[model samples]
Target: MFRTWMRFFTPGAVHHRLGLVCLGVGLQHGAVPAVGPRVLDGYVAVVISSGRGWYRTPDGRRTAVTAPALVWLTPGVPHHYGPDPDTGWDEGFVTFTGPDTATYTELGYIEPERPVVPLADASGPRDVIARIARAARQGNPLLEVETGAAVHELLVALRRARADLAPDGDPVLHALARDACTGMTVADHAARHGMTPAELRAAVRRVAGCSPKDYLIGIRLGRAQELLATTELSVAAVARRVGYDDPAYFSRLFTRRVGAAPVRFRAQQSRAVPDDWNEGLQEDAEPGPPVAEPVDGP
Candidate 1:
């Protein structure tokens, strides 16, 4: 939910619909609308937040998307889509044009000759739309840049998620998952796999492409991302929520792992202020833990 929100709000900086524009189509909770086989005036991205749907492209190829999935469509591409009548559907989308579209084209994230790869990642699709939606409502000055960043994030997330789902199923992956999920110490993780830490590190490196610690950090950061983008919690609150009790330590770790401080990072990813914050919710008067200073700059 946080990921989705971040993606939706990330594009909020875009307002004038510049020569090339990116605008949300809408967000529907209960059911997806039956949309066209005709061309949209601009590019389109269709993401299923929940339920299921089928999309048909100009060339007659068909694809199915369920809860947490995305189907990108290029402008001038004739397409038709609708929810599965029996199951119903909920969906969100963004329409964008401008310099970034060219970037997507160059990267082959989008294809001018065709709709290209209808990239599908349940999380990627959800997060991208959520970020865009957030930016839309916030109406920030940096919207386009944030939305562009969100686009890049989606592509990277899709690539990593695809690799994880590969059919080979390397034995070392089990150790990786365990460390990433349990927050176990290096020695403990090795013991769980019945190996010395040195040997465990070698095995993980050979198969997973990063050190075990780095891998675990990535997993934790991904979770932290989800929390920060969706919840109304303060930076310190979100830090604790994601397993780092020491907010200062978490900020440093987050910067090392995610490339930015949590507050600005979340701000860049999506502009939506939390609901309570928007409603002018005040902090409780009771004294609390020492307030650690957040790091400045990216």
Candidate 2:
């Protein structure tokens, strides 16, 4: 029998205000039977630590596997994949759910309606698999936090493995874009980073093909869409938190950028799109912009 839980690290449990499924890992062995394709309930990722097999999907498809590879299965996508009966496979797998996981779908990480990404190298996934298995078996309170961190690490490794797969976009530019979208002006961010606005704009354009301000707006709009979908905040409240003071202006900007009013955007998002993100929803109640706390309280 395949073990769903294994013993490893003892990270404490995590509490998510918004919904996020638990993180867990397992290893299993099975011979692929000629059965109907299995559709994933959510996001399922498999790292073939060692195996030889072939997987197929409808529309006449096949993935020949030997050595280590990753397979990602997104929710509701139908596909048939399993080990060859001749050489039954050994596999390590994990499952997780949250807004970020949903975002991966948008980014095409779990697409092709094909939910698997076979890693070219096994070492990274192997180590992470061990850690997660141990943590699950131990059942530590901090498992959520630890498991989340481990998932992030695994994603980073996967990004490295698939770096050539993404467009040439600077990570710094992406950070700046996010900062700008959250209401930081290009001039303000440039000043903070010891660069003039023109210099910052030039750098951003070179990599992201957009001016700093435009990129920022894109980032902010994306965040607003997330909030509108997941929270009960009024349009004005969402605007204010995202750095817009006038709710009317925010609605106009949302319509111009996102092609819909805030209310409509929220409706569309909830109806079909599932957002697992919960980050910016709490900002409205956070008193003010985040600041470093005093090292030692008076």
Candidate 3:
């Protein structure tokens, strides 16, 4: 008599805008019986983390579902599935739908024709389903968006599992990318990851198709852009926040790469004007050395 836990969500305008929304998530284990041979209104992805089961499709086709496998319960499709009553099984599921789901179906990402997908590695989908369940329980203001993003990640994991794609990139380089805002030099970061600078650079280039310095700089610039657009932080503060100790140096680099001074960039973003801010500027425009500020910039 194992208890089942389930949560349902009502999506809002934001969820609709994202073109995807999670409707519900649930978990069940031990002595679970068969469920209806009826049609459902929304898409459901059921993953069996343990034990075994059987799934029947609308066309009376049957398939044995083993551990670490997934069964897609497509919208408006008649299906029946359940765990072995004697052995039972641990199950986790997320129900979701969106306008983009049709596109995904058409692209063969979500194959209603092939409902049972054997997963070589089920951990990713399991984790995502747990995340969706947790978000549903917490009922946060951004639950829809958060769960929607998780659903997208879940789909990606499923596709990777189906394609047998191993995780790409070095773990050390991935950690460095995540901690790029720490302001450490490339050599220091490499030492921390127990790799030489050259090794780190090669690994980054192999996986990210960029040098370590360029990858780190991209991460920092992305964060800086977010801070500039969303917050009222001063230029120096934003620079420091993204690991740049010198605001002047940061401004010069940003101008060279992003084609705008930080202050002018912030002003343009705040105003939301569509003027040709870079009009008359040479295609190969290169700024002088790092300066605190530039006149007529952006």
All candidates' TM-scores?
0.43, 0.48, 0.56
Global lDDT scores for all candidate models: 0.60, 0.63, 0.77
TM-score of 2: 0.48
> Candidate 1 residues 1-298, lDDT tens each?
2122223322333433442445443566554456787786567666565677787867788877665555667766788877787777666666666566675565445545643233334566566657766766554877776665555565445444342344345666665664453435666667777888888777666446556677666776786787677666677766654445577888898898788899888887754665765342332354244432221111
Please write out the lDDT profile of model 2 over residues 1-298, one tens digit for every residue: 2223333332233344233444567777656344248775656667777767777766658878665677776677676777778777778777766667755544444444544455556777668867777767444776777676677566555544442333354666756755643546667777767877777776665444557767767776787787788777778777766767667877998899888889888887854333455544654554344322111111
Supply the TM-score for candidate 1. Answer: 0.43
Best by lDDT: 3
Clash count list over all predictions: 24, 22, 0
**In candidate 3, what are the lDDT values of residues 129-182, reduced to their tens digit?**
888877885748778888999888888777666533345635776787787877
Instruction: Give the range of the ten consecutive residues with the poorest summed lDDT in model 3.
Output: 289-298
Model 3: residues with Cα > 4 Å off, grouped in runs = 163-298
The number of the candidate with the highest TM-score is 3
Q: Residue 156's C-alpha lDDT in candidate 1?
A: 48
